[model samples]
Target chain A: MSVSVSANEVADAPQEARERTILGLTADAWLRILMPLAIGVIALGGWEWAVRANGVPSYILPGPIEVGQTLVRDWHTLSISLWITLQITFAALFVAALLGLALAVLFAQSRVIELSLFPYAVILQVTPVVAIAPLIIIWVDDIRIALLICAWIVAFFPILSNTTLGLNSADHNLQDLFRLYRASRWQVLMRLRLPTAMPYFLGGLRISGGLALIGAIVAEFVAGTGGRASGLAYRILESGYNLQIPRMFAALVLISLTGIAIFLAMTLVSHLALRHWHESAMKERR
Target chain B: MLAGVKAGPPVVTLDGVVKRYANGTLAVQGVDMAIGQGDFVSLLGPSGCGKSTVLRMVAGLIAPTAGRIGMAAGGEATGDVGFVFQEPTLMPWSNTLKNVMLPLRLAGMNRGEAADRAAAALAEVGLKGFEKAYPRALSGGMKMRVSIARALVTKPRLLLMDEPFAALDEITRHRLNNDLLTLWQAERFTAIFVTHSVFESVYLSRRIVVMAARPGRVVEDIEVNAAYPRGEVFRTSAEYAAHCREVSDALHRAMGE
Candidate 1:
């Protein structure tokens, strides 16, 4: 037994430890990089060709090129508005994450609480943010605070629902061990349940990121938060009202870019935190 | 004091301990047994014989439906009850040392000193160098070793193991069996192991309590005169084979196989 164990020790050394490295570059890699660019170029070229061929004025169906030019022209105005939108989106998301996790823990601890409150959460989720946003504006005197609350209501439920499920999903056996150790409820929660809930929480976070952006955009429409603390939504609405079709297209382009950027940022953060071996993060490495 | 009185003057006793699930399936019944301090015992039976349930009952992880359980002077927190599960059950996120340190950490020991004791416990289980590795990174046997380390890390007066070797390969099992015997000798912990293998039970235990299923109860108690620090030679000896056969026959008879 001693000899065998010694041999295992010898074998245990990290000799050719079989790293999970991707071996060779394939057409897939190039496909990933070029496919989007190709699609974007093709779509924009088609739009340009259609607008020019039809002899449509810029006010009606302006080309992507015209929007880009408008974007360049209105960079300073767009930047301030983008910054405001970004701030509200992030702040609401932060509050939503904290509240979501807290509510999850609360729900996980008591079946009675979970059963009683889960329906209300579902209702909040299904209720249109557009409907609630105006109500929030009417109730709250401060426009900034009201918009934040509206964004929060829109974005918070997904996070709360998903994270509650995550916290409840801890391994039964591990929980038994913790109980046997006479670990305090807090210790068990922090040391075992929270870490176990991480991947799920991150999953919720990814989903909620897009929801947060949508919430901010939707809230802006309802808040009519213009002239002061105006966002990309206000820019789009202003351009639409003024019949600056090219500028409206430009604002639309900016909004889309922000959404894409938020999605990528979230994906990157998830990858960095859980990329070690989590299944969700494996897509990019492959 | 009341627990001691209810237990009726035994170091450890299970009186008519029956466990019935909500669906009315009885896991254990009328299991009366007593263990003195410094005894090495094994609950030997076929799978689903409720042997694991018995161990869990003793460990206070599961309550027996119809039994009076009594622990010795130290009480429930005896601070001496250590349980090693069938699966390693090491927290996947924790490294080997941290996994072993779990109980001590739970006991409110300072982190630095707890790590120190945890390191020594790991060394005692022959897992000296793999302290930094996570349970996911370790082999099955290595993970089991970490469990053993965690079990012994507290220097518990009693150790409860449920089929600790069932998941390992034979080579690893044999090594763990030897290592376990050595640990028992050095620590002198009152060890109660649950196993389906009569050979394994006969090999390590001083007394083997054979159990039968479908309302599990101990039907036989066989004494093994195996000496301390039992090594490989004992495993291959005539005495060892005789003990194995007796326990195996008893188990077969208990199972009605």
Candidate 2:
């Protein structure tokens, strides 16, 4: 009757996982790292070859080498802007995690509360962040605060949705055992539900990491922040307007690096949390 | 409460304990039973019968819809009541020793004392070297052993199990039946086991209480004259076979066979 043990963790897992991965193998230990790196390398290589062969203008599609030069030349400016973007992303992420977890716990505990507000949450998730960013910007006045609200809106749902399901979807037999032993509700959550939810929570965080980055950048673009406190997005737009193609490519590199850093950091955390107990993070081949 | 005490003052009693669901499903009706001190009893029935329901009620996990159930008042429930579920049901996130220590933690025993108690229990269950291994890392039989260790860790006066070894292979089940008998002999604790297998009932229990489905109630109460620490040779004996067959046939009759 229950679909899969993994359903509570990865709701959007591919319906049919592909077997092919450049060879006849189901998995590779470093595939998560290797696969992404490989894709990035191949993409950059193609971009370089396309530019050279067609003799296109550098302003349109700056090659990786030119982008690297621009990055080195404007290191201080890029670093400051990147730091601002990073600050907003992490702040939003922390708030979203706290709020999402609290909401999940609330919903998990009471059916009435869950039933009353779950539809509103669904509506919030479905509504676009871009549509709400302008409103949040107008109300907040502070550019940083506006960007945080936008990013939180984009990132909060996955945590809440995944965590609520994880809390509810604990092994029923294990739950019965805990009840039989008269374990308190707090004990049940601390010992059972939280551990079970870690994988799901991490999976949610992985998706939300990308969303949060996109949200921060888009929020910057929409709000148009001041000179001294501008983010990577502002620099990106500034470069584009001035036709600084290599510098634009440099900004693009920073954004991609941020996304990759967020992804890798989350993956590392996921491995650390579940490495000992779960099959998902198993290292030794059986 | 008076009804529970009315059963001639048993160590534990279930008097007219009816369990009817809101869906109008009467799983158990007026089930009266008493377990004396230090007795090994098995509630045997088919899949749908209320053997497990009775076990759960005894373990205080589920309350009956009607009538009274009582244990010796304030008699150390946290420390003196150990329950083994159908499957291992070990906290998969915890190691073997930690799983065993859970009851001790609930009992408010200190960590060092709990660890010592858990160690002793694991040794009793023949899992001395596996204290650090997680449940998922263990085989089916080993996990069940850990479950048994966890149940026995508190040195509870009463232990309740609901088809604990039902998921195990035949050899594992037989081996564990022997191991369980040895543990019971060593511990001298009261145990109430729920099982659908008549063979397991005959093999393990000093008394077998057979029940029927659709208003679950006892249809037969028979005693096995087996001694403590029973072994594999007991299974091959004519007397054991006769008892097993009788219990099997009684089970068949209880199911309206």
Candidate 3:
């Protein structure tokens, strides 16, 4: 048994010493970036090759090159649409964050408010944004405000629930310590509950960041197709009607990129905020 | 003279302190005890004895369901009463200095003065170089030291500790026990410590109140005549052993026959 243990240790020694890296990136980080890149390249290459080999019509199936060329050709129009979509997404996210955080704090402070209002939050979350968009677009005079409201509705609840959970999660012993110090209600809320809720609120913000984009795109589809200033969703619909399939693909690419940008931005914000104290952001020690 | 026989004026007095939870569970019944000025007393009992309940009541963390507690009027002027919980309840988000500064800040002291006193308190607990270190960076013993530093920062007249060193290893526990005794000697605050360890109770307390569970109340009060400034030598000596045995006997009796 001792001989086998020694042999096992010898086998593990080299494994421990081997510091895996790819072009100065740690192996884990390299794999995370490269794996998705490889998949995207392979998928796009296959689609381009298959369309060329099959002699598919440009209107039916545009090659990746055609899509790339169309994206460059319609840069000015698509860029404007991209900017509009991004503004609505971010504005809605900002409003959701403020409203959700304020409501969560209120709920945390009073059980009566939480009980009365929490069910409505759940109700709002369960109802689909797609179903509510047409009515919202028709009722509101300003199209942008109507779109903002729809996006805010979809992005609001996660922040509320997660912040509430985090607020309630302060250690019981620490709460007693606060009481022992005779900390005023405001002091406890500002110093303790707010800090405790920070990581949870950031987590919810990341989720809401993506959802806000989706809600914006979906709302724009309803509003723009109903006759309004075009965001990327409307650009795609217009391209489809004109049989500019490559431009539609370019518009879709821009929308996907916008979603990715929002996600990355939120992630960077979370990392910056939590790196000093939270376990989630801390670097692991060997 | 016996240790508690020469007790000073009562710093804390509990008269028939009964604690009944809203769930209809009686935690402790008729707990009548008085802590004199500058006393080191231990509420020694097994788990579920409600010794913690009594300490919490004294700290004003909770109210007694059926009785009154009186404190010396001048005790409040010393500072806020300190409470060190079983776990090292230092705020994870704050550094050692900030954690210790919490009480003084709550009392509305300016940041500069509070920082000076907090740093001094941390130094008193042998955490001189660790003022900027967070609780997560410290060991269990060091974390408990930070907790102690925070408790004593207010220059409290009374300190209530609930098994503060019970989670530490034997070596750390003994070192902390010695350190605590030293601090108590220097500061001379009235302290009520709750612990289940018989050896710990004997080693630390001037008067050990052995308690029974199930509507907890004091079963026996044993005074340790062992001299002040107890160390490792005293821990192994005949006098300490004798005191330990007597306390152990009281504890066993407190538990059952």
Candidate 4:
């Protein structure tokens, strides 16, 4: 009887396993998507109900439907502003990545240089971008360049510090092995130190993405530059002076959405890069 | 007296080697030994005995404060030495094949040749189909096997292992020990193994150098007259037991010193 039961189990195992996985995945995946979506719907419904029930004016508190209508009505202007903001954000992030990586490598190569210069990086990070934007605009002459500088400053330090730590954190035993093989400095940096620093660099990049967006928005706010080439932040400022509350809220929604989109893109890039090797990106498997 | 069945000319010679750290700690003192070509020697001692320091000095990872360590012509050049740490010490970012191919790539070997050699080395260590597996995906023993494969990928003349299997479970440790010995026999590389386990020292080495701590120095060197390809039967043999007893006694004596 035991032998026959065992045989039956072996025969039924594959189909049973396949059925279980399909059902399991569907349940799990649905919960993950539905939970957040349900919360969002409830919150929006409450907001819409409260606005109507209280008879709040559109200027003071637009309902969710009014906000959505404003977003669609102002799509052309808002999108152009969004494009400008996105351009600055991504440009700042790109420059920050390049400069941060270069500076970190420089720091890795020499202790004396790091000791002399690293305090300045800290100073730049701690000093608020808003505090410096006006002076930067005055000194740089170009408003766009000034805004770019501000965003770059905000996004630079994380990458530099994280990559430096990662480069220095290469396994000591591996360093010894490299030395035993008499590897050159170039080989050590490229083959060992750089690979070790990759996850750390990606981590910093994710943080800097959001920061770059905030920096751009803040710098533009301080710049107060109006018309033609104005970012979403300018749209908010312009709408405030004109009492366009619904348009202002619409701009806020776009900014928040952009920030979320940038974060998701960074996460996807990190997952793709490290899915094969890193603990952070790996999925559980038998 | 140091005695061993010398296999060939001495591949590595250490004469009165001393290592004093920058903080003025006398890590090792007056250590003298010669490892013959294709010989397996274990530096057995408790912690703080500087056995690892001595191994590092031999591998040229660190210079001795007051002694001379000479390697034979074929053993002194770049890529002629391989060192394994107590931990697997693999690059977490790379797959097994890439990790094993590192030395060859560092030495400027072409991609195709390096890949073939790395794959062969992986196969030699029983990791043939795991070339693409990352270190995080592997079990401890499998990771250690990849490390061993990486070490031997260059076919180094001298292999320095500092307690390579000390962190493993007893069963895994024993299996790795057997596999390591098989590799040594097939590769014909001189090995300097560091360990604190008496049974491990007795089972793996042709000669065991028992060391003492606090101004770390060798107290006794005993030779094992057992034959090659020692397996489970040899491990359970009376001869192996006797050798283990002798080494354990020497270790105790060294500790007491």
Instruction: Please name the candidate that would achieve the greatest lDDT relative to the true structure.
Output: 4
Which residue runs does candidate 1 get wrong by more than 4 Å?
A1-31, A45-56, A275-286, B1-10
lDDT per residue for candidate 1 within B1-257, as digits (tens), equals: 11121112356888888998788988888899998677788998877778998888888988888878888878477358888888988887678889898999999999999999999988887777878876656677778888888988888888999888897778778888888877876776788898888788888888899999877778999888766567788888998998888888898889888
Which has the greatest DockQ? 1
Regions more than 4 Å wrong, model 2: A1-43, A284-286, B1-9, B73-76
Tell me the whole-model lDDT of each prediction, alpha carbons only. Answer: 0.81, 0.82, 0.86, 0.88
Question: Which ranges in model 4 have alpha carbons more than 4 Å from their true place?
Answer: A1-29, A284-286, B1-5
Give a tens-digit lDDT track for model 4, residues B1-257. Answer: 12334568899998999999999999999999888888999999989999999998988889999989998887767778888888988888888899999989989999999999999888888777778977776767778888888888998888889999887778778878888887887788889999989999889999889999998999998999998778899899999999998988888899893
TM-score of chain A of each: 0.88, 0.84, 0.90, 0.91
**What's the residue-level lDDT of B231 in candidate 3?**
80
Q: Which window of ten consecutive residues has the lowest lDDT sum in model 1 chain B?
A: B1-10
| Chain A superposition TM-score, candidate 4 | 0.91
The CAPRI class of candidate 3 is incorrect
Give me the overall lDDT of model 3.
0.86
Residue B22 of candidate 1: its Cα lDDT? Answer: 87
DockQ pick, better of 2 and 3: 2
List candidate 3 stretches off by more than 4 Å.
Answer: A1-24, A225-229, B1-7, B76-79
Give the distance in Å from residue A64's predicted Cα in candidate 3 to where it truly belongs: 2.2
Candidate 4 residues A44-70, lDDT tens each?
Answer: 999999999999999999999999999
- Give the clashing pairs for model 1: none
Per-prediction DockQ = 0.29, 0.22, 0.20, 0.28
Task: Indicate the worst ten consecutive residues by lDDT in candidate 4 chain A.
Answer: A1-10
Clashing pairs in 2: none
